[model samples]
Target: MRSKTAKLISWTTGGFLLVLAAFRAPAEVTYFLLSTRLVGSALGSCVLPLTKPEDIAEARREMTLDQPPLIPLVRITAGADGINRDYLAPGKPSWTWHVTGFVGFVEGVPEILESTPALVERRQGGWFHDSSGAATVAFTGYKPVAELTREQIFFASAQLTANGMDLHWVDLGANYLYTVETSSSFSPANWMPAPGGSWPIAGTNWVDIATPLSGPRFYRVKAELKSP
Candidate 1:
C-alpha cells in the first residue's frame, strides 16, 4: 500500500542524497534542478491502471484532458495495490486535491486477520469419536435348596437345580471389564470374588456366559475406552 510520496522516495533514492549534500556547508548544490526532476518522476509513475470495472468507467466518464485519452488532470495518486491495501475514495478521508496533486496516506490501515478461521458447528462426512458402550448381566431363574437360618445361608449352601435359567451379557466396544462375585448372605458387605473371579479381554465383544440356574453368583460389566 505504497503512497505517492513513498513511491517517489523509492524512485529517487539515488538522487535524494544530493539534496542532503546541498543542505550542508560540506555538501554540493542540488539546485532547483532537483525540484523539477522530483515532480516529473512523481507524476511519471502516476499513470497507472484502475483494477475495478467501476473505477475504470468512472474514469472514462469524468476524464477531463485536452488530449484524446486524457483522464482527469487530477488523480487519487494510489495504484490498485494501494487502493486495496489502504483506502479507496469510498473510505477515504475528507480532503481535496488541486490539479495533479494528492495527499499521501499512512496509518489507519485496515487490519488483516490471516490467522483466525471460520467457526465450524458441525462436520458433514468424517467424524472424530472415542469408543463408548453399554452392557447388562441377567440371571433368568433360581431356587433355594431349603430356607436357611441367617447363620446357614453360607454352609447350608443351596443347590441350584438344573432349570431353564440363563446368565449372559454383551459389550460391543474397544474395552470391557467384568467381575463375578459371590456372597453367603445378600448383605452388601459380605460379597467377595468367586474362584477365578476376573478376566481381561481385548474387548470387541458379544459375550454370553449363559450359565443356567447358578448357585449364588453375581456379575457386573463395565466398558471403557481411551483414544488419542
Candidate 2:
C-alpha cells in the first residue's frame, strides 16, 4: 500500500525530476512524459465493478435457513499485472466507507481490508503504469464455521484446550438447577461435586476448568430448567 502511495506521489514529482535530469537531452524528456500518460491511462482502465447494495441483499436472500453468519469478500488489486492482489472484508475489514448521499441505495461504503494501492508508472513491457484499485462492494456467504445451536444440553461432552476443558449446557427452563462432577478416574468413588454456581440466565452457558496434568480427566453436567 505504501508502495502504491509512493508511486502516486512519484506521478506528481517524476515529471519535474525528469525535466531536470533531461535538461541536456530534451528529446528524452518528451518521451518520458508521454510514456507516463499512457501508463496512467491503462491503470485507470483496470477498475473492477463495485459491489451494489442490491447485490448484497440478493445474496442474503439466496441463503437458506441452514446458512448463517455471512461473510463478505472484497477484492483489492495493486496493478493490471495482477501480481499484487489481495482480499478485503473478511470477518472484518480494516476500513469502511459509508454512502449517505443516497437513500434506498447502497446503504454503506464497502469495507477495505487490502493495502492502499497507487498507480505506478513502470517501464516494463514498453512503458505502462500499474492500476491500483479497490472494490466498493462485497458478496456474502455462510461463515466459515457451521451454525452453532444457541441452546443445547450434553452429558459428558467437553472440549479440552490449553487453558482448560470447556463444558456447556442448555438450561431448559429447569430453573437453571445444575451441578458438575469431575474425576481423574472412572470409579464413582472418585467422582465428587465440582464447585460452581448457577448461571445468571437459563440458557446456554459454559465453564472452564484447568486441564488435568496427570491421567485423563472426566466431567459431567446435569441441568434442569423448570417448566414455565
Q: What TM-score does structure 2 among the candidates reach? A: 0.27
Q: Can you tell me which runs of candidate 2 are displaced by over 4 Å?
A: 1-157, 195-203, 225-228
Cα displacement (angstroms), candidate 2, residue 204, comes to 3.7
Estimated TM-score per prediction? 0.20, 0.27
Count of clashes in candidate 1: 0
Model 1 misplacement above 4 A: 1-166, 202-217, 222-228
> Model 2 over residues 75-148: C-alpha lDDT tens digits?
43223321111122132111122111111212233443211222222222221223533332222221211111
Name the 10 consecutive residues with the lowest summed lDDT in model 1: 2-11
Could you tell me the lDDT of residue 177 within candidate 1? Answer: 44
Model 1 agreement with the true structure over 1-228: per-residue lDDT tens digits: 110100000012332211110001111211100011122231111122233445444444433322232112212211121111101213221111111221111222222201100000021011112232111111011111121121211011121124311222222222334333333333463544434425333332222233322233333233234323
| Overall local distance difference test of candidate 1 | 0.21
lDDT of each: 0.21, 0.29
